[model samples]
Target: MVTSTLDRASAYTAAAAVLDPEVPVLTIEDLGVLRAVQVAEDGSVDVTITPTYSGCPAMQTIADDVATALAEAGFGPVRVATVLAPAWSTDWMSEDGRRKLSEYGIAPPSPPSPTTGDRRNGPVQLTLGRRPELVACPQCGSTRTRELSRFGSTACKALWQCESCHEPFDHFKAI
Candidate 1:
């Protein structure tokens, strides 16, 4: 399909609007999975995305959604590239995404400490010296939430329970 610049832009918009299957409350862009979007002169669409983690199962679904959205937008010859280099970080998550996560009953990731090294620089390493960060409860907006488990329904999240509401919720853990 021969798409104009405007149409290409629309395609990008549509692709960006694709929501993550694992986290329906967050879009691919919101999860920082969307890396690049390029519309070739021939009207072919190229989308580059990075997985949240190496073994993240949502990657395939995300790629498929990108292709489907672009095709629906009248863009043909769509190519979805999975870029592994420069690992994804919660830091890449947009402010709007954080807000949406919070509203969806998931606590957003806390900012990295200044003294710590950048996790993106090397392979994902779980550090022993890593200090536990406080997470607010999405239910009653209380800071008195306790982590029930390190792993949540998804790999990107941790199970947490709100003390005030006694509600169980997922917290988007910092990686």
Candidate 2:
């Protein structure tokens, strides 16, 4: 059976709806990883994706998943391209994505402060009063939590200890 251009486009859209394996709460689109889908004149499908971070081990799996999804949707000769530029930022995360992250036991990034200095020059010297509020626990919704480690299972996340629940969970670090 031959598929029409419109049908192929719709299929790509549907396939892109799948959520990231690591962060199931946010769909690939919501996370801004699914960049573009273009159907070639000969019916070949090209998918563009931007990794959330460099050296992310999940990227290979994500590419494979994209290919599988397109193949399942009846597309042949699917190409997945990884574009790295304009690095991903927590600000790119959608409001719905943030909510989903919290629901999935990962605390979303806290809002940026006006006085937060850029640390590129040197170590950030935050004034005591300018420190951002602690991220609340996703499980108990308590603000009482302490940083266990700067790095969690992934470099993009941090491990935090929730005092109220006595549980250790990963928090999506603010980029």
- Candidate 1: residue pairs that collide: none
Cα TM-score per model: 0.88, 0.80
Off by over 4 Å in 1: 1-8, 112-126
Question: Which residue window of length 10 is worst by lDDT in model 1?
Answer: 111-120
Alpha-carbon local distance difference test for all models: 0.85, 0.77
TM-score quality measure for candidate 1:
0.88
Name the best candidate (by TM-score).
Answer: 1
What tens-digit string does per-residue lDDT give for candidate 2 at 80-158?
8898765666656677788888888989986445654332234334244524458899999999999988889888899
lDDT of 2: 0.77
Task: Give the TM-score comparing model 2 with the true structure, all chains together.
Answer: 0.80
